[model samples]
Target: MAQGKLERTGFWPGDARLVISISMQFEAGAQPERGASGPFPPLDPKYPDLPMQTWYDYGVKEGIPRMLDLWDRVGVKVTSHMVGQAVDRHPQLAREIVERGHEAAGHGQTWEPQFSMTPAQERAGYLASIASIERATGTRPIGFNAFWLRGTPNTLGILQELGFVYHIDDISRDEPFTVPVNGKPFMVVPYTLRNNDIVRYDSPALTVDAYLADLKAEFDLLYQEAGRRRRMMSISTHDRISGTPARVRALETFIRYAQSHPGVRFMRKDEIARFALTAPGVPRS
Candidate 1:
């Protein structure tokens, strides 16, 4: 029940601080494929808006555990956006998440599309995703991050109606904001594509050094500006992309380097949302 006020709205962080929230989207085989051999069936472009990975074949079987090990080695807890289809394929993955002490929230049942759908369609998609996650994990997912970047009208309302605590579909700005959903300011944890390792997907060299340098630069700037701005840095990652050995090595180095700075707190999105609800203007817990 910890809540923080927004600097512009009411509260402001007096301390110069930064929160590092790492988002690792766990899809065993949920990534969309450009070819027919995309690991799973064809991507669902209609209601669910699913990706092209054979989630069950890859993620649950080998992907999640591997990523978990990487996080564990670094002593970092991730906010894993669980894809339901993969969950159904690898049910014990949920148990493992709970056992390992990470937050398992919704990434949609199958990592599908709900952003451009009609209100009813979007609502249906949300509900279906939520139920599937809850049934499989025994913990109702409260955080949602859509597969595609698209967000729809009434999305927050629907999320709150279904008892979600936070959502990360928007990147309109760099900082977290509150949406007045259902009369209360529901938490919006801002996510960014910059800190993600996916940026290296099309790069020429595709080396971990590039990723580390970029991540270090972002954290360095944010850490220095801790006084002027209440900041949180999020690194968006995936199994097939960031889960690889090279990227993980880069991530490990950056995490250690960032931790060297004083007052850099690392927590899940739920923890940030809880803090935001209580201490809006404050730098962070």
Candidate 2:
């Protein structure tokens, strides 16, 4: 029903196209230990360092280049959800994303937890993070995706207050939809737990075949749905996993397959947001 409602939106006027968005989480200013308490630590043993030097190196040096190659091949662009400090540290990389034509949005100062913060503190944290990103790249982020998928209850209003167009904080569905702000609609493009590589860290060895198989199934299912009505799908990859040689092959396969497909359009998060807002017969309610 939601997909049917969204399908009325014009896509290439006739044929279906896929718009792919690549969101990279750049968490350089890490405070994994911030939540520690009097007798214990915040970053429990279970949540060991998610972004270590090895992971960072894979993202910046090796994986980004491969991702760029895939983008070039597909004629798709990314909307990098960079951590504030990552932008500061990776000015050249940030410039390159903008230099080529992708949007550079905020991820956060560090991949620190945010769910427990007070509303005021959360707003302050957000502003400070955005300021850091802007200071480094000279461009303010128009979108927001909080680090570690964490946020405050007052997240949406605060984002509006800060002039953000949309946020990827909600992972309720696969399709791009909108949320209400004072009865004014805003985008809530979907994200996922099953569609991410983070699962690899949780259990089992992640292989290229497994990743591509997951992607292939999702794409096929969504593509099939396009025959009846319009649909959108999303997948996220990390440099640490995707950039790794073991997983990179699967990524390459998935990208190439999507590129070769005739009906899909690769686009960024903002593009989908704009489409949802203006598409005919669609409910921006």
User: Per-model C-alpha lDDT, please?
Assistant: 0.71, 0.68
Error of model 2, residue 90, in angstroms: 1.9
Give the best candidate by lDDT.
1
| Alpha-carbon TM-score of each model against the true structure | 0.82, 0.83
Tens-place lDDT per residue, model 1, 177-252, is: 7878767778889888787655555465756786788888888887766545767888888666676666667788
Give Cα distance to truth, residue 196, candidate 2, Å. 0.8
lDDT of 2: 0.68
* Residue 46, model 2, lDDT: 56
